[model samples]
Target: MKVGLIGFGKTGKAVATAILDNNELCLEWVLRKRTLLEHRSVPEFLGIQSDEPGLIYSSLTTSMEELLDKHPVDAIIDFSSDQGIYTYGEIAAKRGITIISAVSHYGEQEREFLKELAKQTVVFWSPNITLGVNYLLIASKFLKKIAPWVDIQIVEEHFREKAGVSGTAIKIAKVLDLEESDINSVRAGGIEGRHEVIFGFPYQTVRLIHESISREAFGNGVIFVAQNLAGKEKGLYNFESLLLPYFYN
Candidate 1:
């Protein structure tokens, strides 16, 4: 797959590494807000130095216009903020490119925008891309159907400087038909991520927890979704739908 990356943060670098390790995946180019000097390359932005033969050292550009015009890619994976993905989505839609957005904390407007974007090109929006968490969303639904009397609460922990409650917590809450108040958030200790769903009952309690060992979990998700989404039809898809087999099998 010829893939363009839209961010160069921690998770972005992890995904890039995964792509570098995969023979079928190619890192075509990366788009960022700031341009680096001639002394640096895309790897500098990703904080990775390429050592493997045949690995692609992609070019870096600040202009999305130039990229869309010149460097055509099979799909673009974005790990940036919501606004960056928002603008990129508009252009990607017009160019008929697939976009995998993992931007967190989307508002009503962003949600509406993605819906329209999907009409133009295939788009997968995921706040948390871990396979296990996607399974949790489905599990929450089954648990509710089997035990409606059980009260469920969510607790999500992230790094201390993390902003707002995690979208994973919100997604899980939505799956269980619970309000935001039912979620507990902890932002501390430079943790990657962890989520626990507790089912409370008078007679018994059940806890389902998923703790990310590292950001590689998300990189794995990127590969999984990218492989499945290539050349697919235009549609707004999420993690739950991608992992629907977990519920059946």
Candidate 2:
């Protein structure tokens, strides 16, 4: 399947490389800022060579307009801006292109729009795409029951430039009926990513933690979703839905 990548950041580059590792997936186009495209191909920024002989710079683009019938793709795996979701989501719905977005942080109205778009095309939205984090999310459901009276708090740390709470932490808080105040975001030096779910009682605490060793973990999860995204019905999906086939029927 040909994929139109939406970002060229750390996760984006990692995912692009990981997708290329699969024999079935290849990059058709990448949406980057025009400023970044001033001189060289995104591959130069990413430091990876394209498998196609002459398609390196030709495939890099600054607009989704490049994703046309002349250069179509089966699906689009996006890990770009929160704004990119609406931009590509609308076009993909009309064109019947499947979208798997790893971005969170959209307005309520924007989310409503995406939900409507889902009825037109398949849309998978997840904050964090790591299998380990999904496992933690799955555990939250059971953990909620096991300790309904316990207090829930999410503490996460990311690189200094990352603002606000980790989307994974926010999702976990919501599932466990915790407030935003219970979620803490710490910005520090180049920590890959770390999430800790703390369940506290009178005198004890249980911390369920998942620390990413590198960006490759998230990239692996993106490839897994992309590989499985084919032929899915038009609707909204999450990480749990992606895992449903294996965990259930």
**Residue pairs with backbone overlap in model 1:** none
Q: Which pairs of residues collide in model 2?
A: none
Top model number, TM-score: 1
Residue lDDT tens for model 1, 1-249? 788877766787787777666667777776655543322455554466654322222235235676666667878888888887765778888888888998877888888989999999999989887788887778878889999988888999999998888888998888788999999999889888999999998989989999998787887888889987766788999877677755578
229-249 in candidate 2: lDDT tens per residue? 777888998888878678776
Q: Report the Cα lDDT for candidate 1.
A: 0.78
Which residue runs of candidate 1 sit more than 4 Å off their true CA positions?
A: 37-39, 42-61
lDDT of 2: 0.75
In candidate 1, clashing pairs total 0
